[model samples]
Target: MEFWNDIAIEKSWKVLIGLRKEIDFILIGGWACYLLTHTIKSKDIDIIVDFEGLEKLRKKHPLKKTPFLKKYEALIEGISIEIYVPFYSVFAIPPEEIQKFSIQVEGFRIPEPEILLILKQQAELARKDSVKGQKDRVDIINLLMNSELI
Candidate 1:
């Protein structure tokens, strides 16, 4: 299980690095949970890209907006890349503050576990639906457990 998980992460890193678009964004959501908890699995990568940054990406690659999910998406190498725009409105975290807590991974920046947990809590609350909320709850629990906080 661990070996396959490592292989999946390796593939994800390659796909991320292959993107032609400039990645000036902060990593968030499920992938953030995986980054924090090495054993966690994520089927998609979520990032909070600045509006302007996403616009620039649109110029280079096809991006479709998903109103229901409140994110812009582009499929790359069979991987779903969900990009959230306007940092403040989505996560209520200023770009500068996000930068402070971000760590560079394979040329990309990822949020710290603490920030990811806060984002997951907000997501869990905002998603009134039980099904969607369950994912966030699981992510929070996984993060807490892996971090030895609970």
Candidate 2:
């Protein structure tokens, strides 16, 4: 599958926007950083949802319960939609509390850049030495330099 290139990233972003029509979610990960800083487009889409919302998503997609990774997942148009739930998901800040830390922009709810930084930091630690981790470092830098949170 094409990944990280502009075409793939744009397609991923479009998938994210399309999913908003059916589910309520708190945007997170690289896409959230893109909303705040516009640094780099995310190669994949990540979002936080309540249990009810997760069920709705499952009705439409083949959602996988990946307890080991602490999130649910599905694929749409070759882009992964990684779904995080409050109790089951691991995030820098609790997923349920993410709403308190978020603001609406472009019809999507996303955590503030400060929280995004923390989340990116956690991701970097989790995937250190991988290409995704390298992108996380760049995203962290972009947020620190461009976001008002810094």
Candidate 3:
């Protein structure tokens, strides 16, 4: 997965292009944070989509239902992509909010600092594992340091 850290952004753009216009979603989690900080390493991609977006994605790819994670997941080009549908997760950030914080980078719409901070905070609290919680904390800090939010 070390190679993932080097090409994460490029790979993200490829995945977005593959999804095309049919999906309306925002990049979230570690990958999103990495885009901003450009210092973190993430092996997987995390996204949040509305129900309509989920349905649209279903047409193009095989998504395995992961009710446990409040997401539908797929492995694309060796990267695990987790797609969350706002309702089931404790982190229910609306698309409107996401749009407001979104930035277009290399043709991919990625979540900005404020949104990443919000999600990271939520993840820090929701994760029971100390390691995950700590990683979330570090992500929050990175976003804070690198973003224009300060």
Give the candidate number with the greatest TM-score: 2
| Highest-lDDT candidate | 2
- Distance from true location, Cα of 96 in model 2, Å: 1.3
* Candidate 3 steric clashes: 0
RMSD of each: 4.1, 2.3, 3.5
Q: State the displacement of the C-alpha of residue 26, model 3, in Å, after optimal TM-score superposition.
A: 0.6
Alpha-carbon lDDT, every model: 0.70, 0.86, 0.72
Model 3 agreement with the true structure over 1-150: per-residue lDDT tens digits: 233445765676566567646676787787677677776656667787888888877887788997776668988776678887765644646655676778875555787777778888888888847866777888888888876769
Residue 85, model 3: lDDT of: 70
lDDT of 3 at 95: 50
Using lDDT, rank the candidates from best to worst: 2, 3, 1
Q: How many residue pairs clash in all the candidates, one count each?
A: 0, 0, 0
lDDT of 2: 0.86
Model 3 segments more than 4 A misplaced: 1-17, 20-22, 92-96, 128-131
What is the per-residue lDDT of model 2 for residues 39-138, given as tens digits with 9 covering 90 to 100?
Answer: 7888788999999999999998999899899999999989988999987787768887777889987788999777878899999999989999988888
Residue 146 deviation, candidate 2, in Å? 0.8
Q: Model 1 lDDT vs. the true structure?
A: 0.70
Runs in model 1 deviating more than 4 A are: 1-14, 20-22, 66-70, 92-96, 105-107, 128-132, 148-150
